[model samples]
Target: MLDLTAPSFMRAPHEQLVRALDRSCFAETRIILFGKVKLVLGHPEIQDMLKDGGRFAVDARNAGHASPFGMKFLPASLRVLSDNLLALDDPRHRELRHMVDGPFRRIQIEQLAPSIRETADQLVDDMIRDGENDIVAGLCRELPLQVIFDLLGFSDETRGKLHDVMKGVAGGGSAFDVVRAIFRLKPAQAALRREFENVRSHPRPGLVSELANAGGDGGQMSDDELLAMVFVLFVAGHETTSHLLSTATYTLLMQPGAAYQFRRLGREARLVAIDELLRYCSPVQMTKPRHARRDMEFHGQSLKEGERVMGLLAAGNLDSRVFRNPTQLDLARRPNRHLGWGGGPHMCLGLHLARTEVLEALSVLFDRFQELALDTAPDNLRWTKRTGLRGLKALPLRLQ
Candidate 1:
């Protein structure tokens, strides 16, 4: 019944700009159209709609857009991955949050500081050793995946399957892609399931093992649960970070003075630059479509129950009211309230970890790679087809 011949949902630069302009206007328009989906863009009244949980919900089920594989697979696969925290609301979200929050503490991540830097250094070294290459494949993609793999205690033996699963989940939006994604994940899941079962009886010192053996009120995750969380974390966590790093690096490479300014600032200052890049790139340009659970008043419009809303995170970050000269990319934008990570209870659980990864990775690049430049013409670059995640698929570069 689905039209396979229909062109996949791809947004052109102009279309992206148009949607952006609509949001920048700062008017409360409930039914602004976006390709096929109607969105609620830039409603100040929605401020309460976001923080007030009981009214607006993150249920993507009714939104019915076919892009997010996680939303569609919620009944099957994502329920497990989301088990630890992201899926729950209210007391449950708080209860589960308290237990796992300890592991992601600044001190705990700080302890992994050496490991994080080592991963970035090794990846950069490898890239330098191998002259011209797709930076995404050689550099951007490997860093976070390695950190997460090491953290989860997955073996080098399973790296192939791990990569395959990530690819499948990330591109599992269209009908053509869905079949391929499902095929890709089936074998990967079987392998992970076997490993998880093996580890349950004999625990290891990794995050997966900890989750498997964890007890107390937080409730230990089931095998499916473990695999799903690991799956999402490995894919979503690294993929977005990869985008931020690649796009930020590319932006600086394109702009002469920006990279120089960024480098001179040192680690703490570069972190601020990275934060601006996150807002500027808005890699996860859009978030899950939120639907109203009840009649909600937002930015002057009255929305009846069941109306769908897509929060334009990039637009929200660029609103002139919140950010001065909203279009300009000033790395030192103080009090930057960008929602690079979404807000509310369902805010990205791995945000701190992600911040650490991006900051560390960018720090290394600025330090090691001098006179970094693109190997090809700007027109040759190809943007990825993901509606939610904005990034370059391949970045051919030369390091001096």
Candidate 2:
């Protein structure tokens, strides 16, 4: 069994794990580390499982039956955090998703391009002034956090507080750390509840206002649900994209001539390059555990009711049958159907915004800095000590 929480796996994950899993005789194997999670590695099998909503559910709270870590003992605050759209099933998911779907659509997100470009340009300017700094800290971290703060209409004070709160939440890997984060998150949640109510009373031009006004068959979400939704958006919206920017940039820099090739690409081509980067990086390494709705046969393996299954998205992205030369980074790779953003009804809600941030941030960085290189040795660079999410601890670089 692979201990994904170990420091070694956190550093370099995708290659060896995928290789071993792909070569394994079973399509799915039990990993004792993440509560004995039944890891689904094969591309086709993962796709089928993601699409089969009738047989598989995404409620993490209800996944206690499959969790070896004893999630039933988790605090109510922690349990409420799992009540967002990512954990919802069917009608409720569809309802809440429908309410907020229009705002995050491709066309809607494209409207924010000007502001995003401006923010990216400003971040590059700051980096240029510093001459030498960690890209992860200076650019990668700030860009997404700033964008989301602007989008949500959060005040500067609130933004700083929220950043600290999220850092506490993301920094933890163990059960004890999670409990600590939950305790620290109480004030943050209360603040968000206040913001939601404020937005409800006085409409503003932001996602919070949109969500505050959202209504459907299920009626308005409770204060707890709203708080959970905001928490998800804040965490998922920034954390994954920030890591994507850092790792994608690192990957391109590491590959000889890859950065130049990416720079030379046209607008549409650059967009394609972003897609390829997403495929290659597979930043969010795995999906949240999905519970089987009933006893079922999947890929010749029998799964009991409520058994947990996690789609190894990074593995599927590197599957040889689907992507040729799976180990190589092809900037112009076409017909790329990588499950980087997951699939089915539970796909990432902020994908358009994320793509926009990556494209603009990378473009600005390479364009502004003439000769950019790593300040530290590649081996010295560290990965965050967190499971499910893969990202750099710091990306120190010199821009001349």
Best by lDDT: 2
Worst ten in a row by lDDT for model 2: 61-70
CA deviation > 4 Å runs, candidate 2: 5-14, 25-34, 60-70, 130-132, 171-179
Write the residue-wise lDDT of candidate 1 on 1-400 in tens digits: 1111122322123234335555443222221123343343342433444676676655433233342222334334334454434444566667656556676766788788778988888887887787646777766777777887887888665777877667655532333454456455656777788777767888988877777778778587667656656666776678678888778878887765888888888667777787888877777766565666677676666666655656656666666667777667788888788878777776776776777888887777777778667889977877665455667778887666
Q: Residue 72 lDDT in model 2?
A: 51
- List pairs with backbone clashes in candidate 2: none
RMSD, every candidate, angstroms = 5.0, 2.7
lDDT of 1: 0.65
356 Cα displacement, candidate 1 (Å): 2.1
Residue ranges of candidate 1 with Cα displaced over 4 Å: 1-35, 43-47, 60-87, 171-179
Candidate 1 RMSD computed on C-alpha atoms after optimal superposition onto the true structure: 5.0
Give candidate 2's error at residue 117 in angstroms.
1.6
Question: lDDT (0-100) at residue 201 of candidate 2?
Answer: 88
For each candidate in turn, the TM-score is: 0.84, 0.92
lDDT of 2 by residue, 1-400 (tens): 6565566766666677666666752344434344567777777888888888888888743443633222556566677676678878778788877777776789988999889999988887787787748888778878888888888787565676788887666542444565577778777777787787787889888877777787777687777777777788877877778889988889888999998898788878988988888888878878877888778898888888877788878778888888898878899999999888889989999999999999888888777765878888988987875667778878988776
